[model samples]
Target chain A: MQVSVKYFASLRELMGEASSVIDIEENISVSELWQSILESKKVVFDNVMMAVNMEYVKSEHQLKSGDEVAFFPPVTGG
Target chain B: MLIEIRKEAFNAYAEMQYYLDELDIDGQYGATASFVGTMRDFNEDKNITSLTLEYYPGMTEKHLETIVNGAIEKWNLLDVLILHRVGKIKIAEDIVLVATWSAHRKDAFESCRVIMEQLKSGAPFWKKEETTTGVKWVEKNTPGF
Candidate 1:
C-alpha cells in the first residue's frame, strides 16, 4: 500500500518538504510509518500529533492504502 | 456561520455589518459578543518582531466548522463567524476574529468564549514567532478544554 505524508509548521521546517508519497506495507500503524521514514529512535514521538485524512488520530492508528497522514506540532493559534 | 482563512487583512466592523445586513435577524438577537486576537510586540519575554501563521489547508477549516457547530449545539446561538489570518503578520495586526450572536447575552458571551478557547488549542494551526534575534516555533502551554 501507499500513503501520502504531510509535514506542517515546525515539522515542515525540520523535514524540508511539505509533503510526499511513499510506499508502505499493508496495515502499518502511524508510528511504524513515521519511524520507517526518519529511521531515528531519538525523536520524541509523544510530543508530536498525527492526523489521518484530515482528522486527528493516535500514533497506533492503522493506515490504509492512499491515506493522507499528517504530522504536526501542538496547535498554538487563536 | 462564516469561516474564512485569508492572507489579507479584514475590517471587523464591515464584516459584522455585512453579516447583519444579510441575515434576517428580525430583532431576534439581543446581543453579539466578539473577540479579536492581535499580534503582540512581545511574548515570553522576547521582543517579537512579527508572526507567521501556518495551517493545514483542508483540516483547519474542518476543525473550525466542528468547533462552531459544537458551540451552536451547546448554546442558543443565532449566528457565528470566525475569521483567521495566515502568512506573515506584523505586530498589533488582527490575527483572528470570533463572534457570536444570540437572543440572550449569556448565550452569546459563553459561546464566544468557548469558540475562542476551542480554536486556540484544537485547530490545526501553528505560530512562528520572529524575535529580534531569530525565529522560533511557539510551544503550546495551554491545554485544550
Candidate 2:
C-alpha cells in the first residue's frame, strides 16, 4: 500500500519537506507508520495531531492504500 | 453563509456592508455579532514582523463548513460569514473574520463566540511567526471556552 504523508507548520520544518509518498505493508496503523518515520528524525510525538484523508483520526486508526495522512502541531489559528 | 480562504487582504466593514445589502437579512435579523482577529506585533514576548498561514486547501474549507453548520444547528441564526487569510500577512492585518446574524442578540452573540472558538482549535490552519530572533511555528494548546 502507498500512503501520502504530509507535514505542516513545525513538523514541516523538522521533516525538511512538505510531503512524501511511502510504501507500507497492508493494515498498518498510523502510529506504526509514524514510529518508522520518526526513527530518522529528532522530533518527538508529544502534542502532535494527525489526520487521515483530511479528517482527524486517532493513532490507532487503520490505514488503507492511497490514503492521505497529515501530521502537524496543535492548531493556533482563529 | 459565506466562507472564504484567500490571500487577498479584505476590508471587514466593506465586506459586512456588502453582505448586509446583498443578503438583505436585516428584516429577519435584529442583531449581528462579529469578531475579527488581527496579526499582533508580538507573540511569546518576541516582536513578530510577519506571519504566514498555511492550510490543507480542500480540507480547510470543508472543516469550516462543518463548523458553520454546527453553529447554525445550535442557534436560530439567519446567516453567518467567515473569512480567513492565507499566505504572508503583516502585523495589524486582519487574519480572520467571523460574523453571525440572528433574530435576537443572545443567539447571534453565542453562535458567533462558538464559531470562533471551534474554528481556532478545529480548523486545519497553521501559522508561522517571523520574529527578530527567527521564524518559529507557534505551539498552541487548545483552549477550553
* Backbone clashes, each candidate: 0, 0
Candidate 1 stretches greater than 4 Å from native = A40-46, B141-145
* Model 2, runs deviating above 4 Å: A40-42, B141-144
lDDT by residue for model 1 (B1-145), tens: 9999989877766777787889898689999999988889988899999999999999999999999999989999999989999999988888889989999999999999989998997899899999999999997846645
Candidate 1, lDDT over the whole model: 0.88
Q: Each predicted complex: what DockQ?
A: 0.81, 0.75
lDDT of 2 by residue, A5-63 (tens): 99988888889999999999998999899888898675676777889998989999999
Model 2, span B1-106: residue lDDT tens: 9999978888776787788888966579899999998888987789999999988888889899999999888999999999999999988889999999899999
Give lDDT per model, in order: 0.88, 0.88
TM-score of chain A of 2: 0.93
